[model samples]
Target chain A: MKGSSPLVRPGAPGRAGGPDTTRQAGHRATGTGSRRAARSERLAPYVLVAPAVLIILGLRLYPLILGVNFSFTGDGDRNGMVVGLDNYLELADDPLFRTALGNVGLLVLLLPVAVAIPGLLATFIYLRVPGHRVFRSVYFFPAVLSPVIVGSIFNLMLAFDGPLNTVLGTIGIGPVDWLGDPGVTMFTVVGVHVWATFGMALVVFLAGFSTLDSSLLDAAQMDGASLARTIWHVVIPSLSRTIAFVLVTTMIGMLTSMFGLLYVMTSGGPEGSTYLPEYYIWIQQGQMNRPALASAASTVLFLIMLVVGLAQVGLLRRAGRQD
Target chain B: MKQRTLWSAVLVAGLTVSGCGSATRTAPSPAGSGTSSKLVVWDWKSGDATAASYIEKAKADFAKKHPDVTVEFVAQPFDQYYTLLGTAIQSSTGPDVMLFNGGGQLRDRVDALLPIDEYVAEDRQRLAGWDAFSKDGKVYAAPVTLQGHPIYYNKEVYEKAGLDPAKPPATWDELMTDCAAVKKAGKSCFALGNKEGFGIQFFLSGLGSGVLTPQEYDDWIAGKRDWTSPHVKQIFTLWKDVNDKGYNNPGANSTAMFNDSWAIFQSGKAANVIGLMSDIGHWKDFGEFLPPDKIGVMPAPVVTDGATPSLAYDGGIGYGVAKWTKDPKLAADLVRSLTSTEALTAFYAKAGAIASDTTIDASQSGPAAGAIVSAIKGGKPALHVALSSKTLDLMGRVSQKLLSGSLTVDKAMDQMAAADKAS
Candidate 1:
């Protein structure tokens, strides 16, 4: 040990010893190098993931926590002062907020129709319907257009004295107040939203269709099954996971993505019947200068989404197990 | 070792960006640490084709005072202006100067605004609509234009209906008779758009003077409102009655007060509208469609016997200095330049704003503008402007319900009363 030089390589001639001493030195040096390499290998994964973790912490989780904390603070004269559940209490008492929550329920009820339209279209396309290529593009076209453009287009078409009403008149039917009737405005907006977004879901369904077991369909066909029966027996069972994914994603889209349409189409009008929680949050923060109250509404919305998402996953898993 | 160093550098870079994003910026020095080479101004009007000359004139005026300082005017969309301003206020980092609507909008965000009273004192006598931008006896902004709700009518429609276009309705009965004739002539009596719940405010302020007695009107403006008063009830009742009687254009609830209601009037589909005096939907906008001679500004027809109608006016818009500005004096000077006579006159001539500068000549702005100018001396603050932002919003929603027959007048009044009281 005393005679060995620091710069001496394991294989290089060193000291009076020949190949035996050199081989022993080589193993000693190699052991230290391997230990260092192993340490680097262990840390590589953490280094790779560090940026994404920082981004999520900085952009998402931090703001979410800040918003929840801000919800407890006061606005205006009492700004920055904690007011406990005062903002939440105010949200509960507000009729417009109540209406917003009620509309969320309505959107939930309409979620099945929204998912099915896309699922059906995707199926047709997957089955190689005539002009399928064109249909695929045409269906997805609206998805590319901004909600503002769609809302503006629909406003002209759905106006009381608009072309749709004129067509109804020619057909000997009375005009329907598509956007003006409180009872019908929410439905009209939802219908437009579905029309605008179904293409996206359709694409997802088609992607799901790609992985479908062709043999199952062929077996159903051999059993003399009708188209609908075959679809129910073969395609649906095979695409259960896809169906679950669509259901969860579609619900989330309805809850979050309808803001632009609501803003342009109704502005939560016809007696605030079309107010969604997101719109309500905008009104509170933007219009009414009640950011604290808006944050409370946001927290409530987050909880609602969390509960809805969890329940959906639980149900889908149970159904999968039964199947 | 090199790979580990590179990865470490990448991690440091990523964290650095995130740290900058999450860090709270230090408040800008109130005394202006040093004179900023540039000043940023935010307004919805600066981008308009009509307001281009006005903006140029304002910039020129600003340049005269500080040739070295550059002023950047950011024309935000009016829909998102307040929301953006609120975000700016929260972050304590926004334009040095920003535009604000009169009354509740200015009042609510006074915490973020620098009081420019001393800076704007010289322009006080020249400008007309100061009360609207003042909160708690302190001025947060300088008035740029006098916004008023003037009942504008199409003279050509009157001619087609065989009614005297010159002699517009002066009482409730005459208005009803005229509306009947207009209806028979296949034209709507009013071009109303309540989609944003804004139409109700215009309607309330435009027609309020005709229903409430002068004393009651004064009391209401002074915050001594009686929402259950017979006159107040009549205002809401008349709104419903007018809609029920087929006076407003069909689907009024769905119609937007913005370019839509304005469009309805412009296209000659409706005879009359409660139009603005500043910004859009004014005599200038109407003049663009109808012949200048065909646009008429009529006083509100008396709805009650004791009622004495007067114009409802307020500060339409004004620019205020932000509290976070590096240089308050510089920002205030910029605001003053924005409202200078040369700038406001250009604004009036091009944008057709009823310039808040009282001495701005209105002779070339056509007869309707002339009438508006004449009525300003007797104009009262807008009734809607007297209410809090929350109440005004609630009134908008309830007004739609009242028009749709979902809520009775009594029920609507109760809601308004509660909202007014709470706000």
Candidate 2:
């Protein structure tokens, strides 16, 4: 620990050879020592990158490639045999799968709403509103909960004769079928998911807010600029990268991680109206026992995620440039 | 340092995002069964308190035959049972023996099982409803419990509605009239939960006998299903009609059938429910909520004028040997022991199953059990149970849509017919 400090510090000497043999700077720069030094310098980048590169190849890229390959196979009687897109052909004809894809489109349309909720809250917190610390903790508590717990809590609240209906009835509003109606179940599930997860995005936005320049806000207030104008002209341009990160993460969260909520809340029910690709893959692979067909659905989901992620990055970068 | 931390964070997040990938997982390698000391069994029952004694009895029975062989029972959660089984099937190596629900679920996965007809020849006459676990006349699993759809009436609701519980409806018109009276008294006639699509299966099997002509009932079970038949269409029509007429509890489309629909009946919110004969949502569960006398089991009311009503039942659950087992004879022996009279008797006594063993003393189980046992003699294989898993799955969604008035009965029936033909 004593001598190695200089070894890691850039431009530091004393990282030569055995003990005091080549510790002398004049000896280290001669013949074979210089060649070894050059070689180690060349190897530094690879050493730094090894862990992250191996993790991505092993965990992310490998499973994705494996999933796409498996989509060509057959299930049941034809277990291991490759059928070459028979599963995709079947998915095209299936209405339930189509509904799942349609729900993905619905999620895309609601992306802005999900991002804005947390973005606005972060701003309020950044402004140091009354009891901000307490509000931050209370708002972020739901994000710490597992979706199963959240979904179960919402399931009790959203029952037909549950407290929500009772409260609505007291206010002279007609009882809305939160989960029983085919058209309403998907929205109810998505609303619960957003409620449960927005805190994560809120925390991220707060971190971005911490890095914001205080002088710009002070000048805006002095100039009699409205809160909306300040956020639009200053905060938006400064935090574009953070907003982009939140948008991509939130979209991915909706697509991949809402399975637990969908599973518990509506179970893609009220006549299969809430079938997301993630849940559709579950049904095909688990309930329907069509693992091969599930793979095809998964491959399509992967492609959708790729397109959506790239679009987000592109859109955010362009907006940042314009600013 | 910041760049490295960011890369680590991004990679960790990437790894955490997962979905149900269709890629088959590597299955546990097959355990050599010939002279092997261990035999593992997979089921959703062994962990259940009531089913524990049954498992013990079954293991003892098997132990008598193979004194040195040991047994292992792995109980899976009921909800995730099939998915786990599907995973095991794909890998070609799982448990030496497994439990299966009787119908299309068993039929669809027969390739993974060893047909035990030769091993169980002696027990054939004692047990009933073997057809439910068979495909093309070859038995895939032995019947342990008889599951059926019986009309269980809440006599408290009937009495409250100013009707005699003793005289449950004898015809469709009478049932509707009673439902109207119940509604007038601020109660629903039926407690239906179609959320998982199982409510429709119970409905189809429960009321189908009263709707289809006796010939059509036999034909439907015999693989000669006539989707275009008016009587068949009437089953789906009556399903929607009851819900539309406010005969069922509100939110029937959203309610889950597992115990929620049964809860409505138990709480006396409904007059009757087309419920299971075994396991749950039966006389035993309802007996706890209502007095024993108030829990009445009645035959389905007549829907079609000329139709002869009969109890609709089949093998409920059974034990099957895996195809990869090294010793077929030993695994089959284990299946036989699992369904043995002594084992099934303990199952019935503690679990309240209407055991497949016809000789079991069910007289002590009360009048409701007696009625179900007597009905089994005339009962046909359930109409819904006869359909393949694919068809049953399709029927559930279609039935839900039919209840919501999104799809017509004819259109649903057409889809079911197409699925049936393909399967």
Candidate 3:
């Protein structure tokens, strides 16, 4: 009865009366199998994410490295040959590129306004203002539209002879060349960009509002706090992280995502006053056959975004700590 | 033919698969070594509704010559055509034949193209505007359409201004007087759009003949441009003067030269526009809004003494075989079919282009087209076309600045001279 039992199998490792050679072989096999299982368990996370990591490396990082390398090479007759900072020197001398960089600075200065409109709108919605549901949907509507469509629609609305000017004329106000004035065109484009994209930021803010401890807002109200005071004291601190996220994102959007609008409306014109780095890169690479110069411009843009993003994060963290 | 069709199916399948990969990963065999049954072409026009019949006629002509060979025309967006072509060139894989704008666009990328002069020798006598598609006496592409800047005036506006519509201005003074009358009639003297900087191109070329001595005009086209010359400065100064005197449509800096400026002229808001002989801003397009007889074509008014006015035209667009093609002869044959008289006549009829084929009858298009045709013999290469792409681009920007009063003509002339010299 003992020999027929499963536990009494002769070759099982660590059995009380097993033979030495067979038992030793079984013990080694068990050790090897357990070690293999442990190693496989250790590798599971990486194995699960291998495809994604590979994809990111191949598609994003590899091309980025290639592009940075390409920036140092020559274009046209000297193509594929290393030129050692010649493209960067050329970019420095280009007035159009300089205008583009200046526009980037303008965008950075305007970032707070871009973030605040949505924050305020989300606060109003969260407060259950009149027709809050309708306002939420209405505000989010523009975000769903393609930039090309928005740009085209605005082009019609903002032209010198367009409906906007006509309305201004009826109001006894002088008509303004919204898209024509070099001094005003970049502001006009940024204004439109803010309008179109503020919806997405508002949604992010509303989500942040959902996580906010409503008790603090209620406490402020109970203390006879004014709406402005409550927002400045309680709500701003509560949504500090959200504001930081929105600020960095909005800045990135302005720097990178204005190409479609720029392409459709003004085309970086009015004496190159509306030029952005992306549009400048496109013009150099596509129109002027200076891909290396475009690459240099692109690298500069990337560096600007990096520095600005890191600075914003550091500033926001310090502000949050003070709060 | 069935085998050719099967081969076409395979080629399409191959292209579809290859298109999914990076251009470098799927480099196709050159036409000289690959199967000759299928030829791929890239153009901005083939997809246009107007170019349908022209494409069909050309396809039929090509089919007659190589009945066993299949042709695939890939229509690309004009805005991104050159960019995409550059990518293909860098990867060493693309269409067998591609379309190019005749001047700087073609010249800037000649290394990617095969010279078709030997193949198109038979076409020399028949085609006009060959010089535009030629560089250093070697033709790279076959001319398809003739493009020129023609001053188009609205007869109705001229009549409203109490001027003879039949007789347009013949000198700078006459133009100014006509413009004054137009302003009095509450209409703009010119429909101008400098948004994309193309308005300046039309302006310089349209009025160049009027301001420059005939010798200077020829010299400029012959690559001896003197950007600092007094006549050159006058063109920029007069451009600013027109805007300063309220002779152009308001917000000239914002309006696009394409349909926007054309719309101003068509809507009777402006008396005249320096327009094109072919493409969107031509007499045919203007005729769409105004009656054909209401549009009048006139030479540029003389702005300087000893200046002789004539049309400024060149090859508008053309098709060339790529150097990497396995069968240059077959691709060149496709180019020939694309430029054939029958196909061009269809193109002219359907697309309203001034066909590059000189023998094609254009009298039926309109009197404006007729006038353009008559002036062809005296026409010269466009002044702006003579400048390098860099200079042309700078000129466009400065022209906008000049109109905005942010830049001076002297400063613009200096910048232009420097850019030209650099090129």
Question: Which of 1 and 3 is the better model by DockQ?
Answer: 3
A1-323: candidate 2 lDDT, tens digit per residue: 33443455443234434423544545645636655675676566567667877877876666667668889999878888999989999999999899999999999899999999999999989998898889899999999999999988987798777889889999998877788889889888989999999999999999999989999999999999999999999898889888988988898788778788988877888788898887888778767778789889878876777788779788778766765
Question: Per-residue lDDT of B245-351 in model 2, one digit per residue for the tens?
Answer: 98999888888787788999999999999998888889887878787777888888998888888999999998888998867898899999998999999999899
- lDDT string for model 3 (A1-323, tens) is 22233433332334323334544777876666655654555555567667877866765566667778999999988999999999999999988999999998899899989999999999999999999999999999999999999999999999889999999999999989999899999999999999999999999999999999999988999999999999999999888888888887898788768999999998998888999888998788767888888888878877777787779779778766765
Q: What DockQ does predicted model 1 obtain?
A: 0.33
A301 Cα displacement, candidate 1 (Å): 0.9
User: Candidate 2, which segments miss by more than 4 Å at Cα?
Assistant: A1-60, A77-81, A124-134, A210-241, A315-323, B1-40, B64-69, B74-96, B322-330
Docking class of 1: acceptable
Ranking by lDDT: 3, 1, 2
Q: Provide a comma-separated list of chain B TM-scores, one per candidate.
A: 0.86, 0.86, 0.89
Model 3 pairs in collision:
B30-B326, B31-B325, B31-B326, B31-B327, B32-B326, B32-B327
The number of the candidate with the highest lDDT is: 3
Which digits, one per residue and each the tens of the lDDT, describe model 3 over residues B231-279? 9889988999999999999988889887899999999999999999888
CA deviation > 4 Å runs, candidate 1: A1-37, A122-137, A206-235, A315-323, B1-49, B55-98, B111-122, B321-338
What is each predicted model's overall lDDT from 0 to 1? 0.86, 0.84, 0.86
